[model samples]
Target: MEETILVLDKIKKSFDGVSVLNGIDLEAKRGEFITLLGSSGCGKTTTLRIIAGLESPDSGRVLLSGADVTDTEPNHRNVNTVFQNYALFPHMNVETNIAYSLKLKKKKAPEIKKTVAEALALVQLEGYGKRMPSELSGGQRQRVAIARAVVNEPEVLLLDEPLGALDLKLRRQMQLELKRLQQTLGITFIYITHDQEEALNMSDRIAVMRGGVFEQLGSPAEIYELPRTAYVASFVGSANILTGRCAGGGDTVAVDFPGGTGSALRRDWQGREGDSVTLAVRSENVQLLSSDDSRGIPAAVTETRFAGGMLRISSKLEDGTEVVISRYGIGTDLVSGDAIRIDWAAENAVIVLPDSEVAHE
Candidate 1:
């Protein structure tokens, strides 16, 4: 088992008399990559700040490598942060920027030069050390920032949406680079980002935050395949949330949605008959058939569009609930106002408990 390197015990914080981080706990394993994923105002940044010693929690202790660092100064903690902005000193060239931390520690000049060279090489910026920040591209600047942070050899690295400033293509490219850097360094990375794709692509585990608390915390696959709440189902990916009630229960539960009935695999919850439930099915899981086919719920194709090599079909149920289905390949013969039937395998649909039901349990 991996050793626990960082622990946040019941950490709570607030600003301006408004609660930001409602008591939350997280355990990060050594050399693990964990992401705090949520939208703005979700307290992800506040959590990162607390861990970095940039902000103190109103209550709870922060333990780093089994040592209580709740009151430790930012510079005293063995952690480093890279922000959305590169935060590189414009006046300093790449090598100088990366060597600044080593210089502060009063390392021998020879050691600092060697370490800075290694850091630059790790970031694939070997000969660019002499180049100023202004001369580099956005991606190169971000790489330089990462090199600077990793030069400290901190136990844990905190990244706050480091790719947010880059364009889409660059952002995707940096995601791969960041993951490679983390695995190569064998350093624990506590990253923060609101992009779902970024979180899913990069994190070993994700803590989905909302209203200052975790909506769900698990592996990317677990969070995507087995979302615990409707919000998670919707936020993590493209899920069609269908309102329904448990018509019957067993290995498979029958749910009656508006104008149709569907079956979903039974999960951890032992729901009773007639209990209100929500069904979450991914767009890819939904299949569209001709309306003449009687095997599924009837819907009308509201819109169809081609994007990212996938054909996205939007339809509305008889009761006016919008359902979206996605299929690979560009262009579909189906057009707007065409009649269609939507269906999915029983195992593909997930039954989600209502928020109140989940909260009461």
Candidate 2:
């Protein structure tokens, strides 16, 4: 069984009379890569601060290694944070920066030098230790920041959008690097990010936050495939959300929505007759067929675009609801104003409750 390294129990916080965190709870396992994903002002950063002892919660407790540390000071906690700005001193070289913490603890020069060298090698910057922050590239500087944070070997590493400052290509590269680094070092990582792809790519599990609360928390596949709420479905990935009423079925629940009625596998909350619900279907799950196909819903093609390895089609249903479809490979012959029918298997459709109706755990 995995060991629990950190726990946030019903953490609540407010600032200036405005609530930011609403009784959130999370338990992180040792060496786990968990991401707090949400848009701006969603309390993800505030939660990180609370974990690092940089911010105090109005209620609840923070437990690390099964010990309560709710009132611990930031410096006293066995945790380190790496910010987006790569907060490195321009005057200090990489070796000096990594050795700073060790030196402050009054470690011998030989041990500091050996530890610093090991850290540099771990981040793939073995010989670059002599280089100053200004002399290195953006990616290198960020790696140096990571090296400095890891030199002390904190139990938990809190990364606050460490790749936000890098360009698109570089950011993509760093995402894999960070994940590999976490696995290699076996450190518990609590990452914060607003980017869905980044969270999906790097996280072992994700906590999707919204309006100061966690909308959903699950593995990447679970968050994308079986979101518990409509907000989670739309936020964590691309989903075509449609309002519907439950028609009630045995193995599958029939949802009556615009254009047509669709069947979804029943699980958890079985819907009552005529109860309102939401249907979330991924773009790739939507299949476009000939207009003559009677089994599909009629829709008018609005636009089609080639997205490198995939083809994206935008269509509008008779009720004016827009539906997007994505397929891999070359472009399709369908164009604007063309008539098409869209359909999907019952298994591909996910039934979710409205955000207001979703019960928090």
Candidate 3:
């Protein structure tokens, strides 16, 4: 059985009468890398901070390994945070910075030295003990920050956009490194980030937040493939949305999209024909068929761009709604203004709702 390491029961937090976290309930299992993925002001970082004890909740409870820690001080909680800025002491070298936490515990020189050295080795900075933060690259500095946090071996770890400062390639590299470190350490990592790609790449589970509540929570595959909400569908990745409501008796329904009427099969959706709904399909899943293989729907190719790995073509329906289709591999025969059929498999299309939308109970 997987043990629940952290639990938030109806957690609420407000500032000056405006609520930021509106009754958030979530759980993190032991040794899981759970990411809070959302845009700014969506309460992701606030929730992470609440778990860290940096801010006391206005209501609700926080449990750490089944112990109530809502009133505990930041230092007393079994969680450590790595800030976006790395938060290293500008005046100290790598060794002393990591040793600072141990020294606060009053450990002797031999013990602190061993712990710091081992921590450095864990982050692959074994020989950088004498180097200052300024002497190291951005990635290395971030590693030292991780080493500092991991040296304590807390029950949980928190990272707040720690790689936001790095470049694209470095960010990708760090995401892999972070995933590896989490597995090797077996610590529950509660990461918070607004980057969808990074969240999908590094997390065992992802909680999509919107308007101070979790829109949906599941494994990366589940959230990506089986989004429970329209906000999540739009937020997680590129989803071409079509709005309509259920048409009776069976799962097959005729959806009214901006483009045209289309056949879509939805799974267990609780909606009536008059009830508004949205359909979501990924661009990559959309197949661009040749004119000979065309559907009855009229569409015109408006633009095309080569994305190195794939050909991205922008199309417009007769009704003038934009549809983007990404075709894999080499195919340069398409020209602007050419007519084509942009169709996706009925099963590949997803139905979603906006933030204000409700789900079936």
Candidate 4:
């Protein structure tokens, strides 16, 4: 059985009379890497702070390894945080920075030295202990910060966009590094980030937060392939959302869109005929067919752009509904203003709630 390492029960908070976290409940398994993903002011950072005991919740309980730590002070809790700025001391060398926590505990000099060396090795910076912060690159500085946090051997590591300052390539590299470190060290990590790709690539499970609450929570594949709401589908990746109405029923559902009527495999959706529904198809899932193709809906290509590994084609249906499709390659024979047809398989079309329903739910 997987052990529950952390639990947040009905965590709620308010600041200046405005509710921020509205009853957030979550459980993280031992050694799991969980990400709280959302835009700014989504309460992801607030939730992390609450867990770290940096801020007390207005009403809730935080349990770490089954011990209630909601009222505990930040330093008393068995957790460490890695900030986005890599908060290293300019005057201290890497070795001294990593050993600061141990020194504060009055640990012996030899013991602190040994532990710092081990921590440095864990982050692959074994021989750079004597280097000053200014001498290290951004990625190296981040590693030192991780070394410092892990040196304390906390039960949970809370990372607040630690890679936010790095360039895109370095950020990608650190994402993989953090994932590997979590696995190798077998530590529970509660990562906070607004970057969807980082959460998708690194987390064992993701909690999509919005308006101070979790909109959806699940594995990356689950959230990507079967989003529970339109917000999630649109937030996680590129989706071509289309408004439609249910036209047929049974094993499959026929939906009438602005472009045309299409069928989709119905999977326990309890919608009826003439009911408003939305269809979400990933841009990559849409196939561009020839203008003469009888099975496709007629559309006029409005624009095309080469986006490195893929070609993005934008089109407008007869009813003026815009649809975008992505094809893997450098270029497409079709160009702007050309009459084309677009179609997708029934399995690729997902019936979603209308935007209004999504908002209220």
Candidate 1 segments exceeding 4 Å error: 329-335, 355-361
Q: Give the least accurate 10-residue stretch of model 3, judged by summed lDDT.
A: 352-361
Two-way lDDT contest, 1 vs 4, winner? 1
Candidate lDDT values, in order: 0.90, 0.89, 0.84, 0.88
lDDT of 4 by residue, 296-352 (tens): 678899999988588999999887878999988885788789998888888998776
Instruction: Decide which is better by TM-score, 1 or 3.
Output: 1
For residues 306-360, write the lDDT of model 1, one tens digit per residue.
8877899999988788999999988688888998888889899987754665431
Tens digit of lDDT per residue, candidate 2, span 125-242? 9899899999999899999999999998888999999998899999998998999999999999999999999999999999999888898899999999999888888887678876
> Model 3 segments beyond 4 Å from truth?
258-260, 289-296, 318-320, 329-340, 358-361
Q: What's the best-to-worst order under lDDT?
A: 1, 2, 4, 3
Clashing pairs in 3: 230-353, 242-279
TM-score of each predicted structure versus truth: 0.93, 0.93, 0.90, 0.92
List the RMSD of every prediction in angstroms: 2.2, 2.1, 2.8, 2.1
Error of 2 at 255 (Å): 1.6
Model 4 alpha-carbon drift over 4 Å, by segment = 318-320, 359-361
